[model samples]
Target: MANEIFICHNCPMTRTMATIGTKWKPIIIYTIGLKQQRFGLIHAKMGLISKKILTEQLKELEEDGIVKREAFREMPPRVEYTLTDKGLELLPILNLLTEWNSRHHQADFK
Candidate 1:
């Protein structure tokens, strides 16, 4: 008799968490989902996140294929960040999380 041990290499939940499992990633995604495409706009909306950290997060998101960054050449350089299909797919999940938080922590708002 031969005994074989099988191990699951990739877990969907782990992969998903590794992608957007940060204090800022989801908020950044939600802000982008709201149509704020420019860096300044996203930064302004997030108010508390430092520019360095925001830039870093955006870069990571872009590298992970969740966000797309477009740069335009002209007198002033313009760059905009938008959700890729993968990022768009994450919107509903974020929405559900938002709804859950609101329902359970309604008192926090007051």
Candidate 2:
């Protein structure tokens, strides 16, 4: 039974990478975590990602169940992106990765 379960499921790391393997996904997640929900705010926070790429990434994240996109019907139409529960669950892991990178490569960031 255990072997069957293992065979039925993807390796955790592989599954994680499939969801957020790209160089920009984690940064996008972190930016959303910071309450920068609007498209413009996220684009501004990233500073270098082209709008097209950011839009693509956001779409992928939304499809993967890691982010939620809500559109408000109003005069100008406001859209916001927020992390889903699944994405919230990844924050601690992201924080650990950030801390590990900082500890090992402090000079690079400075």
Q: Report, for every candidate in turn, its global Cα lDDT versus the true structure.
A: 0.89, 0.90
* Count of backbone collisions in candidate 2: 0
Candidate 1 lDDT, tens digit per residue, 12-103? Answer: 66677788999999999999994638898899999999999999999999999999998879667878999999999999999999999988
- Give the poorly placed runs of model 1, Cα more than 4 Å off: 1-9, 34-36, 107-110
TM-score of each: 0.85, 0.84
In the predicted model 2, the residue pairs found to clash are none
TM-score of 2: 0.84
